[model samples]
Target: MDRRRTLRQRLATQRLSAAPLPRAADVVRLLACVQSQERDHAFFSLGLRSRDTTYAAVRAAYDRGAFLRTHILRPTWHFVLPDDVRWILAATSPRVLRAMSYRHAQVGLDDPAHVTRSLDALGELLRGRAFLTRREIGAAFGERPGLPSAGEQLGHLLLLAELEGLVCSGPMKGVHHSYALLDEVVPPAPALGRDEALARLAHRFFAGHGPASLKDLARWASVTQADARAGVAATLAATPGALEEVEIDGITHWFDPSLPRRTTAGRAAHLLPVYDEAVLTYPAVNFPAAPGHPTGGAVDPFWEPVIVDETNAGLWRRTVGKDAVAVETRLATGLDHEQRALVLEAARRLADFLGRELDYREVTGGPAADDAKARRAAIG
Candidate 1:
């Protein structure tokens, strides 16, 4: 069979079976398409981490061991499935860590022995504790002499512990955050030897985000292209049925052959937070926007409430006050009446979701227009 036909059939099967699932559940299911493990990285996908509806689905996955917290992909915390985390982390983390090695040295944290000791001490403080706000945890370290300022030392320590799977955030505490020791919160993952881990990760990556080139996997996993290619070969050898190659604009891209063939009707309008995976996973060109409408692709990452049409549209931001939520849209071009109405409706939905009132505004052209970009530049 032609590979494209097989891919279409697989998608058809999924669409037929997707009939009864709720919107939030459906979104969560799609998340599994890109990530085999679910550790719900709170920072990147704020809505998945914070919204009640999405968070519930994510937590359920976590509780079931379908998702776990591991340092994977970008060397940042990612919510991956328990079965997949070990291999993904093993395959990817070293490269990411290596890139940061120089930064560690400049910051006086390059000593492996010192980093390990700091992790052990931090873990002991967090074990069995329900949750400690980052501040509280920092205080624990600050009390110790010869330690860098809590702000400085604790930041690096937490990153190390996260890489080691020693801890993760617990449920939200009224806008205050808490952390729990990983050993206490989740079961131990079986250890995998290096090559086995690398092969498994590569296979899952293609399975979830395949039709991707080896270079794409390498970029996404922050590993060398050689390692990524090794993973690609291993995955194809193990599961030939799962691979499919598609030619887009004369370029062959490998992706999961089984992804759904048709777009579901009534895909809900979402007010995705900054760094939502839907926007972050693919390049900016993948998002659908009004011709010339400023797309989130051009926006920096700190902005919130990215307004997505059926496909990723452009980015939006909202500020909530006691009376109403003020929405600001920065588009590449002016929106027509219908597009404006649609954007307002999205804002209203967001306000309702957050239990606030709605207000709308737009800004186009000039440096001040790019809210996210401006904020990031300011910080830099």
Candidate 2:
């Protein structure tokens, strides 16, 4: 397929420009997992993939235990379904454990017995109460000799416990999210062997976010290339004709055989939150005739919200005051009257989602915050 068609097709398959996924859990399930490091923006990420899911609705589902927020895939927070959480943690924790080995030693949790004891204490504390905030859980283990303070080591310990399937995030308490025992929060799903877990995850990635490469899978999952290849091979074996390879501009891309080619209706404008999967999943996203956009993928260190017309047009940032939400948009190229109106409309939708009045502004620069003088010149 051509460049524009490629972007649209992927976006449609990803539920970005088509009939959105019906439920919040469906979004997480289809994408295998979602990058949710920025909690609010991650809600917006789910919103982008759904038909009519509100921020409140998404939060409600989260509280209702439809999905879980945990350290998975890459050590950052991700929204994973409860059924998948245990296996994903089991499949991927070795890598995370190895990476965090030094921190484990530094925090005096390097000993397996000590780790098990800590988990037992945590489990007992949570069992005493349905959901305990991290602070509350940490307070139980107060400052002790050779043991890191709750502040110093609670997060690490919690991560360790989570990977061990002892704890997972529970309902939110005001602004704070609490933790529950994995057994308490998640419904039982049958266990899978290591190979089965890897295959299922690989299938989800390819089926939901495909036209993806093994390298992309490795990078996204933080697994070795050999593991990625083995998982892909297993996926192909389990479901013959499920994956198809297409050569796009002399590069091979694998995608689900079921997705049909289609154009994205309307202006194709969106205000994607920081770390939205639309930007994170693919290797190099192509934009049609976008001279300002590079096909080789751009590194966004700031994790700014993106304005997507056909591709990554520019970056955006928001300031949420009590009564109003102010959004600023910087376009890679100038927008026409119609395009600008659509962009503003998208921003207004974001304001509605936040339950605040819109204070939308369009300025220019790249992803970075340009100087005040430069901003003035661009606007003027």
Candidate 2 stretches with Cα past 4 Å from truth are 143-147, 286-305, 366-380
- Model 1 scores worst on lDDT over the 10 consecutive residues at 9-18
lDDT of 2 by residue, 1-380 (tens): 66666677777878877777898888898888899878888888888777545778889989988999987877878899987898888888889789989988897788887777777777877884479888876666775444334665678888888777788889889988788888887778878898988888777787777677777788888888899888878888998887887777776667887864454455557887887787677656544323343221255444354446565656667898989999987665645666667778888878877788999888754554444456577679
Q: Per-residue lDDT for 1-380 in model 1, tens only?
A: 34344333322333321232343334333343233222233421323323343444544544444445444567665555444544555666677777877877877787777787777777777777557767877777778764544665567667666665677656545555456786676567777876666666666555544344566566667778778767666667777766666654454556665664444434334455554454455451234554565543455454543443433345566676877878776654645566666666767756655556778887774235445666767889
True-structure lDDT of candidate 2: 0.76
lDDT of 1 at 195: 62
TM-score of candidate 2 to 2 decimals: 0.89
Which candidate number has the best TM-score? Answer: 2
Off by over 4 Å in 1: 1-71, 193-196, 206-211, 267-272, 294-297, 300-313, 332-336, 362-379
